[model samples]
Target: MTDTVLEIKNLEASYGSVQALRGVSLSIQEGTIATILGANGAGKTTILKCISGIVDPRKGSIHYLGRAIGGKRADLIVRMGIAHVPEGRQVFPLLSVRENLWLGAYTRTSRVEALEDLEAVYRYFPILKDREKQEAGKLSGGQQQMLAIGRAMMARPSVLLMDEPSLGLSPKLTEEIFTIIRRINRDWGTTILLVEQNASIALQTASHGYVLESGRIVMEGPCEKLFQDEGVQEFYLGQKEETGVERRRWKKTRKWA
Candidate 1:
């Protein structure tokens, strides 16, 4: 069996006249979390959009579990066992927590298997069970994020693409959410491709890392190597005044997307 769960080569995508992903390529091994770190408008999200088939790649190929999927439809991709939980935690605000979770299984082939997966999700996140009847919008930010993940879990995906899972969250909540992500990876063995601007924690969680700058991969290696490098301080650790004005410039540049 191929150790690589996903492979992207010569990926290029554009919206109108504006190019987003530019000749990007990446490979993700099965049963590991691989994070793509970059600043806002750096095309991190565009990579996810392309892989999930939200935007068709203008050029290049995407292979999922050895099957070419670059041109497939988004829904078709999800049913193929790739679930994308997009940037904004796009939950159904009006729907009940239970209803939102149930909707995730809409594409599943068997209702019984979907129900079994729902139970598994509840085991992973008991809060969703506690708030089963609550309106999704009424939940706290952390609860809402949990619901978003829970909804994705209901789809029974083998590969989970999470975009900015900790966006707009408190530090405590971010830690909590990342802990769940770790458990999900270790326990369920689902391969994950996480896109985030929070490089510090993201690198710590991922087995390997890739650093993206303005739609291109500028650096990539072992997570520990990138973690200790001085360059990582530019984006991950925040800049330093001792390094002078050029280094000070990073303080103003928004990294979050």
Candidate 2:
């Protein structure tokens, strides 16, 4: 079997006349965490949308496990072992936590196996187990985010697409969530494609990284290289050296594509 789990080539998409992704391409290796980092409106979320079938690519191809999956329906994609934990932690407000998690296994037929997976999810996020019968809407933001991830876990995906998993979270909660994400990757061996604005946490969490700017990939490399790059340090990592010297030096040396 090939090591690459997901591949995108020349991907282009838009909303009406406004283009969101322009000739974007990237790859995720099996059993590794990969991240896409960019500012707001940089087409970060759009890439995840296209992969999960929420939006169709106007051009190019998306291959999952060496098979093209660009135009498949979202539900079909989920059943094919790709689960999406969307940007906004979109949990069902009125549904009990247990009910929401069960809905994630809607594609599966074996009740016994699904129950076992449910127990595993509880083990991963013990708080979800504590709030099993509570209304999902009543949970704290951090708990709700946990629920969103738990819901995706119920699908038992081979590849997990997470968009802005740390949005609107306290620093402590964000660290906790990312810790769980790392454990999920290492323990379950699930391939992940994470999109985030929190560059520091994301770069630290992922093994490899892609930097997107205005709907295009500007930089791609291993996490350590990205973390050490002067440009990345100044722009993304919030490291500003004395009197803006490093910032100016970065601007002079780097050129965008």
lDDT of 2 by residue, 1-257 (tens): 63999999999999999999999999999999999989899999999999999999999999999889997899989988999999989999999999999998999889999999999999999999999999999999999999999999889899999999999999999999999999999889999999998999999999999999999999999999999987788678888666855446534554554
Alpha-carbon local distance difference test for all models: 0.87, 0.93
lDDT of 1 by residue, 66-162 (tens): 9999979999999998888878788899999999999999889899998898888888789999999999989987888888898988888899999
- Which model scores highest in TM-score? 2
Consecutive 10-residue window with the lowest summed lDDT within model 2: 245-254
For model 2, the superposed segments whose C-alpha errors exceed 4 Å read 243-254
Q: Candidate 2 has what TM-score?
A: 0.95
| Highest-lDDT candidate | 2
TM-score for candidate 1, please give it: 0.91
Residue 56 C-alpha lDDT in model 1: 95
Give the Cα error of residue 178 in candidate 1, in Å. Answer: 0.4
